[model samples]
Target: MRIIIGSKNPTKWKAVQDVFDTYQVDTLNAPSRVSSQPFSDEETREGAINRALQCAESTPGAIGIGLEGGVMYIKDQLYLCNWGALVTEDENIYTASGARIVLPIDIAEQLKAGSELGDIMDQYTRKEEVRENEGAIGIFTNDSISRRNMFVHVVKLLRGQWEYWINK
Candidate 1:
Protein backbone atom coordinates (compact mmCIF):
# COMPACT_ATOMS: atom_id res chain seq x y z
CA MET A 1 0.00 0.00 0.00
CA ARG A 2 1.16 3.48 -0.83
CA ILE A 3 1.29 5.90 2.12
CA ILE A 4 1.08 9.58 1.27
CA ILE A 5 2.37 12.00 3.85
CA GLY A 6 1.16 15.58 3.96
CA SER A 7 4.39 17.37 4.83
CA LYS A 8 7.91 17.48 3.47
CA ASN A 9 9.47 17.64 6.93
CA PRO A 10 11.95 14.88 7.51
CA THR A 11 10.87 14.37 11.11
CA LYS A 12 7.28 13.67 10.20
CA TRP A 13 8.45 11.45 7.36
CA LYS A 14 10.72 9.55 9.70
CA ALA A 15 7.87 9.00 12.15
CA VAL A 16 5.68 7.52 9.46
CA GLN A 17 8.55 5.57 8.00
CA ASP A 18 9.23 4.00 11.38
CA VAL A 19 5.69 2.64 11.63
CA PHE A 20 4.84 1.92 8.02
CA ASP A 21 8.30 0.61 7.29
CA THR A 22 7.55 -1.72 4.41
CA TYR A 23 5.13 0.51 2.57
CA GLN A 24 5.86 2.69 -0.45
CA VAL A 25 5.83 6.10 1.19
CA ASP A 26 5.64 9.43 -0.63
CA THR A 27 5.33 13.06 0.39
CA LEU A 28 3.82 16.28 -0.92
CA ASN A 29 3.86 19.78 0.48
CA ALA A 30 0.30 19.90 1.75
CA PRO A 31 -0.59 23.02 3.72
CA SER A 32 -2.10 22.78 7.19
CA ARG A 33 -4.49 25.60 6.35
CA VAL A 34 -4.42 26.83 9.94
CA SER A 35 -2.41 29.23 12.03
CA SER A 36 1.32 28.57 11.74
CA GLN A 37 1.22 28.12 15.48
CA PRO A 38 -1.98 26.43 16.37
CA PHE A 39 -3.09 27.62 19.80
CA SER A 40 -5.56 24.92 20.76
CA ASP A 41 -6.29 21.24 20.32
CA GLU A 42 -9.25 21.99 18.06
CA GLU A 43 -7.21 24.09 15.67
CA THR A 44 -4.30 21.70 15.71
CA ARG A 45 -6.54 18.73 15.01
CA GLU A 46 -8.23 20.65 12.24
CA GLY A 47 -4.90 21.42 10.64
CA ALA A 48 -3.92 17.76 10.75
CA ILE A 49 -7.25 16.67 9.31
CA ASN A 50 -6.96 19.24 6.57
CA ARG A 51 -3.54 18.06 5.58
CA ALA A 52 -4.58 14.41 5.58
CA LEU A 53 -7.67 15.12 3.55
CA GLN A 54 -5.72 17.16 1.04
CA CYS A 55 -3.10 14.49 0.59
CA ALA A 56 -5.69 11.73 0.17
CA GLU A 57 -7.57 13.86 -2.32
CA SER A 58 -4.43 14.63 -4.25
CA THR A 59 -3.63 10.96 -4.65
CA PRO A 60 -6.74 9.06 -5.64
CA GLY A 61 -5.95 5.77 -3.93
CA ALA A 62 -3.66 5.96 -0.96
CA ILE A 63 -3.60 6.56 2.77
CA GLY A 64 -2.70 10.12 3.81
CA ILE A 65 -1.08 11.02 7.11
CA GLY A 66 -0.62 14.39 8.81
CA LEU A 67 1.20 15.25 12.00
CA GLU A 68 0.85 18.59 13.77
CA GLY A 69 2.31 20.12 16.90
CA GLY A 70 0.76 22.91 18.90
CA VAL A 71 0.18 24.35 22.36
CA MET A 72 -2.86 24.53 24.56
CA TYR A 73 -3.87 26.00 27.89
CA ILE A 74 -4.83 23.95 30.89
CA LYS A 75 -5.54 25.85 34.09
CA ASP A 76 -3.68 28.91 32.83
CA GLN A 77 -0.58 26.82 32.12
CA LEU A 78 0.52 26.24 28.56
CA TYR A 79 1.40 22.74 27.39
CA LEU A 80 2.87 21.48 24.15
CA CYS A 81 0.52 19.13 22.31
CA ASN A 82 0.74 17.03 19.18
CA TRP A 83 -1.93 15.57 16.94
CA GLY A 84 -2.04 13.27 13.93
CA ALA A 85 -4.59 12.27 11.34
CA LEU A 86 -4.90 9.39 8.92
CA VAL A 87 -7.31 9.45 6.00
CA THR A 88 -7.95 6.40 3.91
CA GLU A 89 -8.87 6.52 0.24
CA ASP A 90 -12.41 5.59 1.22
CA GLU A 91 -12.54 8.77 3.33
CA ASN A 92 -12.23 7.03 6.65
CA ILE A 93 -10.54 9.43 9.05
CA TYR A 94 -8.72 8.48 12.21
CA THR A 95 -7.23 11.06 14.55
CA ALA A 96 -5.05 10.67 17.63
CA SER A 97 -3.20 12.88 20.08
CA GLY A 98 0.25 12.27 21.53
CA ALA A 99 2.06 13.08 24.73
CA ARG A 100 2.21 16.63 26.06
CA ILE A 101 4.58 18.43 28.35
CA VAL A 102 4.10 21.58 30.35
CA LEU A 103 6.12 24.42 28.93
CA PRO A 104 8.27 26.53 31.17
CA ILE A 105 6.70 29.77 32.33
CA ASP A 106 9.05 31.78 30.16
CA ILE A 107 8.17 29.84 27.04
CA ALA A 108 4.49 30.00 27.90
CA GLU A 109 4.79 33.75 28.25
CA GLN A 110 6.43 34.03 24.86
CA LEU A 111 3.65 31.98 23.30
CA LYS A 112 1.09 34.27 24.89
CA ALA A 113 3.04 37.14 23.34
CA GLY A 114 2.37 35.65 19.90
CA SER A 115 5.73 33.98 19.36
CA GLU A 116 5.61 30.67 17.59
CA LEU A 117 6.97 27.76 19.61
CA GLY A 118 9.50 26.79 16.98
CA ASP A 119 11.00 30.24 16.84
CA ILE A 120 11.01 30.56 20.60
CA MET A 121 12.55 27.12 20.99
CA ASP A 122 15.22 27.96 18.44
CA GLN A 123 16.10 31.07 20.40
CA TYR A 124 15.83 29.28 23.74
CA THR A 125 18.13 26.46 22.68
CA ARG A 126 20.29 28.60 20.42
CA LYS A 127 19.80 26.04 17.70
CA GLU A 128 18.50 26.23 14.15
CA GLU A 129 15.51 24.23 12.94
CA VAL A 130 14.77 22.61 16.26
CA ARG A 131 11.29 21.77 15.04
CA GLU A 132 12.81 19.63 12.31
CA ASN A 133 14.87 17.76 14.86
CA GLU A 134 14.70 16.98 18.52
CA GLY A 135 12.21 19.85 19.00
CA ALA A 136 10.96 21.49 22.14
CA ILE A 137 9.87 18.15 23.52
CA GLY A 138 13.43 16.90 23.46
CA ILE A 139 14.70 20.05 25.07
CA PHE A 140 12.10 19.88 27.80
CA THR A 141 12.34 16.14 28.33
CA ASN A 142 16.13 16.08 28.16
CA ASP A 143 15.88 13.82 25.09
CA SER A 144 13.91 11.19 26.98
CA ILE A 145 11.45 11.55 24.11
CA SER A 146 12.55 13.23 20.92
CA ARG A 147 10.05 15.02 18.68
CA ARG A 148 10.32 12.27 16.10
CA ASN A 149 9.49 9.65 18.69
CA MET A 150 6.54 11.69 19.84
CA PHE A 151 5.19 11.75 16.32
CA VAL A 152 6.00 8.09 15.93
CA HIS A 153 3.69 7.30 18.81
CA VAL A 154 0.95 9.37 17.27
CA VAL A 155 1.40 7.61 13.94
CA LYS A 156 1.20 4.26 15.63
CA LEU A 157 -2.08 5.23 17.23
CA LEU A 158 -3.48 6.39 13.92
CA ARG A 159 -2.29 3.33 12.04
CA GLY A 160 -3.59 1.04 14.75
CA GLN A 161 -7.00 2.62 14.56
CA TRP A 162 -7.04 2.32 10.79
CA GLU A 163 -6.04 -1.30 10.97
CA TYR A 164 -8.79 -2.08 13.45
CA TRP A 165 -11.44 -0.39 11.35
CA ILE A 166 -10.40 -2.14 8.15
CA ASN A 167 -10.25 -5.49 9.87
CA LYS A 168 -13.65 -5.07 11.47
Candidate 2:
Protein backbone atom coordinates (compact mmCIF):
# COMPACT_ATOMS: atom_id res chain seq x y z
CA MET A 1 0.00 0.00 0.00
CA ARG A 2 1.06 3.53 -0.67
CA ILE A 3 0.37 6.36 1.74
CA ILE A 4 0.50 9.98 0.61
CA ILE A 5 0.92 12.57 3.29
CA GLY A 6 -0.85 15.84 2.62
CA SER A 7 2.05 18.00 3.70
CA LYS A 8 5.67 18.09 2.72
CA ASN A 9 6.79 18.61 6.32
CA PRO A 10 9.26 15.88 7.13
CA THR A 11 8.14 15.63 10.71
CA LYS A 12 4.55 14.89 9.77
CA TRP A 13 5.66 12.46 7.09
CA LYS A 14 7.94 10.67 9.49
CA ALA A 15 5.14 10.33 12.00
CA VAL A 16 2.96 8.60 9.45
CA GLN A 17 5.87 6.53 8.30
CA ASP A 18 6.52 5.34 11.82
CA VAL A 19 2.98 4.06 12.13
CA PHE A 20 2.71 2.57 8.67
CA ASP A 21 6.29 1.60 8.16
CA THR A 22 5.43 -1.31 5.94
CA TYR A 23 3.68 0.83 3.38
CA GLN A 24 5.18 2.93 0.62
CA VAL A 25 5.12 6.55 1.77
CA ASP A 26 5.13 9.76 -0.23
CA THR A 27 4.61 13.43 0.58
CA LEU A 28 2.78 16.20 -1.21
CA ASN A 29 2.05 19.83 -0.48
CA ALA A 30 -1.67 19.84 0.08
CA PRO A 31 -3.33 23.06 1.16
CA SER A 32 -5.06 23.05 4.53
CA ARG A 33 -7.42 25.82 3.44
CA VAL A 34 -7.66 27.15 6.98
CA SER A 35 -5.97 29.72 9.13
CA SER A 36 -2.26 29.14 9.55
CA GLN A 37 -2.83 28.99 13.29
CA PRO A 38 -6.13 27.36 13.97
CA PHE A 39 -7.70 28.66 17.20
CA SER A 40 -10.33 26.00 17.82
CA ASP A 41 -10.50 22.21 17.89
CA GLU A 42 -13.19 22.16 15.21
CA GLU A 43 -11.12 24.27 12.85
CA THR A 44 -8.02 22.23 13.50
CA ARG A 45 -9.80 18.96 12.73
CA GLU A 46 -11.35 20.54 9.69
CA GLY A 47 -7.94 21.44 8.36
CA ALA A 48 -6.69 17.90 8.78
CA ILE A 49 -9.72 16.42 7.08
CA ASN A 50 -9.46 18.89 4.24
CA ARG A 51 -5.86 18.04 3.55
CA ALA A 52 -6.48 14.30 3.73
CA LEU A 53 -9.48 14.40 1.42
CA GLN A 54 -7.76 16.63 -1.07
CA CYS A 55 -4.69 14.46 -1.27
CA ALA A 56 -6.71 11.26 -1.45
CA GLU A 57 -8.74 12.65 -4.34
CA SER A 58 -5.65 13.80 -6.15
CA THR A 59 -3.82 10.51 -5.75
CA PRO A 60 -6.03 7.60 -6.58
CA GLY A 61 -5.36 4.15 -5.00
CA ALA A 62 -3.32 5.69 -2.21
CA ILE A 63 -4.23 6.54 1.34
CA GLY A 64 -3.92 10.22 2.23
CA ILE A 65 -2.88 11.47 5.65
CA GLY A 66 -3.06 14.91 7.17
CA LEU A 67 -1.61 16.32 10.36
CA GLU A 68 -2.35 19.70 11.88
CA GLY A 69 -1.29 21.51 15.03
CA GLY A 70 -3.18 24.38 16.59
CA VAL A 71 -4.27 26.06 19.79
CA MET A 72 -7.58 25.98 21.59
CA TYR A 73 -9.33 27.48 24.56
CA ILE A 74 -10.79 25.04 27.03
CA LYS A 75 -12.46 26.39 30.17
CA ASP A 76 -10.80 29.77 29.62
CA GLN A 77 -7.33 28.26 29.44
CA LEU A 78 -5.45 28.16 26.17
CA TYR A 79 -3.91 24.85 25.16
CA LEU A 80 -1.94 23.47 22.25
CA CYS A 81 -3.80 20.85 20.24
CA ASN A 82 -2.86 18.43 17.46
CA TRP A 83 -5.08 16.51 15.07
CA GLY A 84 -4.57 13.84 12.37
CA ALA A 85 -6.70 12.38 9.58
CA LEU A 86 -6.51 9.36 7.27
CA VAL A 87 -8.40 8.97 4.00
CA THR A 88 -8.64 5.47 2.57
CA GLU A 89 -9.24 4.50 -1.05
CA ASP A 90 -12.80 3.52 -0.23
CA GLU A 91 -13.53 7.06 0.94
CA ASN A 92 -13.44 6.12 4.61
CA ILE A 93 -11.91 8.84 6.74
CA TYR A 94 -10.52 8.21 10.20
CA THR A 95 -9.38 10.94 12.56
CA ALA A 96 -7.87 11.19 15.99
CA SER A 97 -6.41 13.90 18.22
CA GLY A 98 -3.56 13.90 20.67
CA ALA A 99 -3.22 15.25 24.18
CA ARG A 100 -3.12 19.00 24.73
CA ILE A 101 -0.92 21.05 26.98
CA VAL A 102 -1.82 24.38 28.49
CA LEU A 103 0.09 27.22 26.93
CA PRO A 104 1.87 29.94 28.84
CA ILE A 105 0.25 33.35 28.77
CA ASP A 106 3.13 34.83 26.82
CA ILE A 107 3.02 32.17 24.12
CA ALA A 108 -0.75 32.55 23.93
CA GLU A 109 -0.32 36.27 23.52
CA GLN A 110 2.16 35.80 20.70
CA LEU A 111 -0.17 33.41 18.93
CA LYS A 112 -3.05 35.78 19.43
CA ALA A 113 -0.92 38.51 17.89
CA GLY A 114 -0.83 36.52 14.60
CA SER A 115 2.47 34.72 15.06
CA GLU A 116 2.32 31.05 14.16
CA LEU A 117 3.47 28.68 16.88
CA GLY A 118 6.21 27.28 14.70
CA ASP A 119 7.56 30.72 13.87
CA ILE A 120 7.30 31.91 17.45
CA MET A 121 9.05 28.82 18.66
CA ASP A 122 11.73 29.26 16.05
CA GLN A 123 12.42 32.80 17.20
CA TYR A 124 12.18 31.94 20.89
CA THR A 125 14.52 28.98 20.65
CA ARG A 126 16.80 30.57 18.06
CA LYS A 127 16.45 27.43 15.96
CA GLU A 128 14.98 27.05 12.48
CA GLU A 129 12.23 24.57 11.55
CA VAL A 130 11.32 23.72 15.11
CA ARG A 131 8.07 22.29 13.81
CA GLU A 132 10.01 19.80 11.71
CA ASN A 133 12.15 18.81 14.65
CA GLU A 134 11.40 18.50 18.31
CA GLY A 135 8.58 21.03 17.95
CA ALA A 136 6.83 22.92 20.73
CA ILE A 137 5.93 19.70 22.48
CA GLY A 138 9.55 18.69 22.67
CA ILE A 139 10.52 22.10 23.98
CA PHE A 140 7.71 22.07 26.50
CA THR A 141 8.55 18.56 27.64
CA ASN A 142 12.28 19.01 27.46
CA ASP A 143 12.66 16.49 24.62
CA SER A 144 10.54 13.84 26.28
CA ILE A 145 8.01 13.92 23.43
CA SER A 146 8.42 15.51 20.02
CA ARG A 147 6.01 16.83 17.44
CA ARG A 148 6.67 13.84 15.22
CA ASN A 149 5.99 11.45 18.07
CA MET A 150 2.77 13.24 18.91
CA PHE A 151 1.57 12.73 15.36
CA VAL A 152 2.77 9.18 15.56
CA HIS A 153 0.47 8.55 18.48
CA VAL A 154 -2.45 10.05 16.62
CA VAL A 155 -1.67 7.97 13.57
CA LYS A 156 -1.60 4.87 15.70
CA LEU A 157 -5.07 5.65 16.90
CA LEU A 158 -6.27 6.13 13.35
CA ARG A 159 -4.74 2.84 12.35
CA GLY A 160 -6.38 1.08 15.23
CA GLN A 161 -9.72 2.46 14.18
CA TRP A 162 -9.11 1.37 10.62
CA GLU A 163 -8.12 -2.10 11.74
CA TYR A 164 -11.23 -2.50 13.82
CA TRP A 165 -13.47 -1.32 10.99
CA ILE A 166 -11.84 -3.61 8.48
CA ASN A 167 -12.03 -6.58 10.77
CA LYS A 168 -15.67 -6.04 11.54
Candidate 3:
Protein backbone atom coordinates (compact mmCIF):
# COMPACT_ATOMS: atom_id res chain seq x y z
CA MET A 1 0.00 0.00 0.00
CA ARG A 2 1.14 3.52 -0.67
CA ILE A 3 0.41 5.73 2.36
CA ILE A 4 0.58 9.50 2.21
CA ILE A 5 0.92 11.62 5.35
CA GLY A 6 -0.47 15.13 5.47
CA SER A 7 2.06 16.98 7.57
CA LYS A 8 5.48 18.59 7.24
CA ASN A 9 6.23 18.17 10.93
CA PRO A 10 8.98 15.57 11.04
CA THR A 11 7.67 14.44 14.38
CA LYS A 12 4.21 13.64 13.06
CA TRP A 13 5.55 12.05 9.94
CA LYS A 14 7.96 9.89 11.91
CA ALA A 15 5.28 8.83 14.35
CA VAL A 16 2.97 7.80 11.54
CA GLN A 17 5.69 6.13 9.54
CA ASP A 18 6.89 4.23 12.59
CA VAL A 19 3.48 2.59 12.87
CA PHE A 20 3.40 1.46 9.25
CA ASP A 21 7.09 0.75 8.95
CA THR A 22 6.71 -2.77 10.28
CA TYR A 23 4.18 -3.52 7.59
CA GLN A 24 5.11 -4.15 3.98
CA VAL A 25 3.88 -0.78 2.82
CA ASP A 26 5.48 2.37 1.38
CA THR A 27 5.13 5.84 2.94
CA LEU A 28 5.49 9.39 1.68
CA ASN A 29 4.89 12.95 2.94
CA ALA A 30 2.06 15.02 1.44
CA PRO A 31 1.09 17.48 4.18
CA SER A 32 -2.34 18.94 3.73
CA ARG A 33 -2.49 21.63 1.11
CA VAL A 34 -5.01 23.24 3.43
CA SER A 35 -4.22 25.65 6.22
CA SER A 36 -2.59 24.22 9.34
CA GLN A 37 -3.89 26.79 11.73
CA PRO A 38 -6.60 25.58 14.08
CA PHE A 39 -9.97 27.25 13.92
CA SER A 40 -12.77 25.03 15.25
CA ASP A 41 -13.05 21.33 16.00
CA GLU A 42 -15.20 20.58 12.96
CA GLU A 43 -13.10 22.69 10.66
CA THR A 44 -9.95 21.07 11.93
CA ARG A 45 -11.29 17.60 11.25
CA GLU A 46 -12.32 18.67 7.80
CA GLY A 47 -8.84 19.97 7.19
CA ALA A 48 -7.40 16.59 8.14
CA ILE A 49 -9.94 14.64 6.10
CA ASN A 50 -9.48 16.84 3.09
CA ARG A 51 -5.75 16.41 3.15
CA ALA A 52 -6.01 12.68 3.56
CA LEU A 53 -8.56 12.41 0.80
CA GLN A 54 -6.49 14.55 -1.48
CA CYS A 55 -3.52 12.26 -1.08
CA ALA A 56 -5.63 9.14 -1.51
CA GLU A 57 -7.17 10.46 -4.67
CA SER A 58 -3.86 11.52 -6.09
CA THR A 59 -2.39 8.03 -6.16
CA PRO A 60 -5.45 6.18 -7.49
CA GLY A 61 -5.12 3.26 -5.05
CA ALA A 62 -3.08 4.74 -2.24
CA ILE A 63 -4.13 5.24 1.39
CA GLY A 64 -4.05 8.78 2.72
CA ILE A 65 -3.46 9.81 6.34
CA GLY A 66 -3.61 13.14 8.17
CA LEU A 67 -2.60 14.22 11.66
CA GLU A 68 -3.44 17.49 13.34
CA GLY A 69 -2.40 18.94 16.72
CA GLY A 70 -3.87 22.06 18.30
CA VAL A 71 -4.70 23.82 21.55
CA MET A 72 -8.18 23.85 22.99
CA TYR A 73 -10.01 25.43 25.92
CA ILE A 74 -11.37 23.00 28.45
CA LYS A 75 -13.21 24.14 31.59
CA ASP A 76 -11.62 27.58 31.55
CA GLN A 77 -8.20 26.02 31.10
CA LEU A 78 -5.99 25.81 28.05
CA TYR A 79 -5.38 22.29 26.79
CA LEU A 80 -2.26 22.40 24.68
CA CYS A 81 -2.45 19.26 22.52
CA ASN A 82 -4.83 16.68 21.05
CA TRP A 83 -4.75 14.30 18.08
CA GLY A 84 -6.97 14.79 15.05
CA ALA A 85 -7.73 11.98 12.66
CA LEU A 86 -6.60 9.14 10.40
CA VAL A 87 -8.63 8.60 7.23
CA THR A 88 -8.55 6.21 4.31
CA GLU A 89 -10.00 6.40 0.84
CA ASP A 90 -12.34 3.64 1.98
CA GLU A 91 -13.75 6.13 4.50
CA ASN A 92 -12.34 4.53 7.59
CA ILE A 93 -11.21 6.45 10.65
CA TYR A 94 -8.58 5.69 13.27
CA THR A 95 -8.72 8.61 15.64
CA ALA A 96 -6.32 8.92 18.53
CA SER A 97 -5.78 11.08 21.63
CA GLY A 98 -3.51 14.14 21.49
CA ALA A 99 -0.93 15.30 23.99
CA ARG A 100 -2.37 17.28 26.87
CA ILE A 101 -0.84 20.15 28.81
CA VAL A 102 -2.37 22.45 31.38
CA LEU A 103 -1.60 26.05 30.63
CA PRO A 104 -0.57 28.31 33.49
CA ILE A 105 -2.96 31.12 34.30
CA ASP A 106 -0.77 33.80 32.73
CA ILE A 107 -0.55 31.89 29.51
CA ALA A 108 -4.25 31.15 29.48
CA GLU A 109 -5.07 34.82 29.85
CA GLN A 110 -2.80 35.69 26.97
CA LEU A 111 -4.45 33.05 24.77
CA LYS A 112 -7.79 34.43 25.82
CA ALA A 113 -6.72 37.80 24.47
CA GLY A 114 -6.59 36.35 20.93
CA SER A 115 -2.82 35.96 20.89
CA GLU A 116 -0.85 32.92 19.84
CA LEU A 117 0.70 31.55 23.02
CA GLY A 118 4.25 31.60 21.76
CA ASP A 119 4.00 34.97 20.07
CA ILE A 120 2.43 36.61 23.10
CA MET A 121 5.10 35.30 25.40
CA ASP A 122 7.71 36.38 22.90
CA GLN A 123 6.54 40.00 23.28
CA TYR A 124 6.23 40.14 27.09
CA THR A 125 9.52 38.39 27.85
CA ARG A 126 11.48 39.98 24.95
CA LYS A 127 13.89 37.08 24.98
CA GLU A 128 14.10 37.11 21.19
CA GLU A 129 12.70 33.81 19.87
CA VAL A 130 12.34 32.01 23.19
CA ARG A 131 8.86 30.70 22.36
CA GLU A 132 10.08 28.58 19.47
CA ASN A 133 12.53 26.79 21.74
CA GLU A 134 10.79 27.01 25.11
CA GLY A 135 7.18 27.84 24.26
CA ALA A 136 4.87 28.03 27.29
CA ILE A 137 7.36 26.47 29.64
CA GLY A 138 9.98 28.96 28.46
CA ILE A 139 8.10 31.62 30.39
CA PHE A 140 8.84 29.94 33.69
CA THR A 141 11.60 27.33 33.51
CA ASN A 142 13.54 25.23 31.06
CA ASP A 143 12.04 21.75 30.77
CA SER A 144 12.49 18.79 28.44
CA ILE A 145 8.75 18.61 27.87
CA SER A 146 7.66 18.83 24.24
CA ARG A 147 4.48 18.21 22.24
CA ARG A 148 6.44 16.06 19.79
CA ASN A 149 7.16 13.44 22.45
CA MET A 150 3.58 13.52 23.59
CA PHE A 151 2.30 12.92 20.07
CA VAL A 152 4.53 9.87 19.61
CA HIS A 153 2.88 8.14 22.54
CA VAL A 154 -0.62 9.00 21.41
CA VAL A 155 0.00 7.73 17.88
CA LYS A 156 1.04 4.34 19.21
CA LEU A 157 -2.56 3.15 19.34
CA LEU A 158 -2.20 1.44 15.97
CA ARG A 159 0.10 -1.08 17.61
CA GLY A 160 -2.72 -2.96 19.36
CA GLN A 161 -6.11 -1.28 19.32
CA TRP A 162 -6.38 -0.28 15.68
CA GLU A 163 -7.75 -2.72 13.09
CA TYR A 164 -6.01 -1.91 9.86
CA TRP A 165 -8.36 -1.95 6.93
CA ILE A 166 -5.49 -2.01 4.50
CA ASN A 167 -4.23 -5.14 6.14
CA LYS A 168 -7.68 -6.61 6.31
User: Which one is best on lDDT?
Assistant: 1
Comparing 1 and 2 by lDDT, which wins?
Answer: 1
TM per candidate comes to 0.98, 0.97, 0.66
Model 3 lowest lDDT segment of ten? 130-139
| lDDT per residue as tens, model 2, 44-91 | 999999999987887779888889999999887889999999999888
* Selected candidate, larger TM-score, 1 vs 2: 1
lDDT of 1 by residue, 15-71 (tens): 999999999899989999999999999999999999999989988899999899999
Query: Which candidate do you rate higher for lDDT, 2 or 3?
Result: 2
Ranking by TM-score: 1, 2, 3
Q: Indicate the TM-score of model 2.
A: 0.97
Error of 1 at 167 (Å): 0.6
- Strongest candidate by TM-score: 1
Residue 40 shift from truth in candidate 3, angstroms: 5.3
Writing each residue's lDDT as its tens digit, candidate 3 over 1-168 gives 666776665655666666777644334455545444453445555666666666666676666666665566677777665454555666666666554667678767766667775576678677655433544543443456544454456566533344555557
What clash count goes with each model? 0, 0, 4
Model 1, C-alpha of 33: deviation from truth (Å):
0.9
Q: Score candidate 3 by lDDT.
A: 0.58
Position 68, candidate 1: lDDT? 91
lDDT score at residue 55, model 2, on the 0-100 scale: 79
RMSD of each: 0.7, 0.8, 4.4
What are the clashing pairs of model 2?
none
Question: Candidate 2: which stretches are off by over 4 Å?
Answer: none
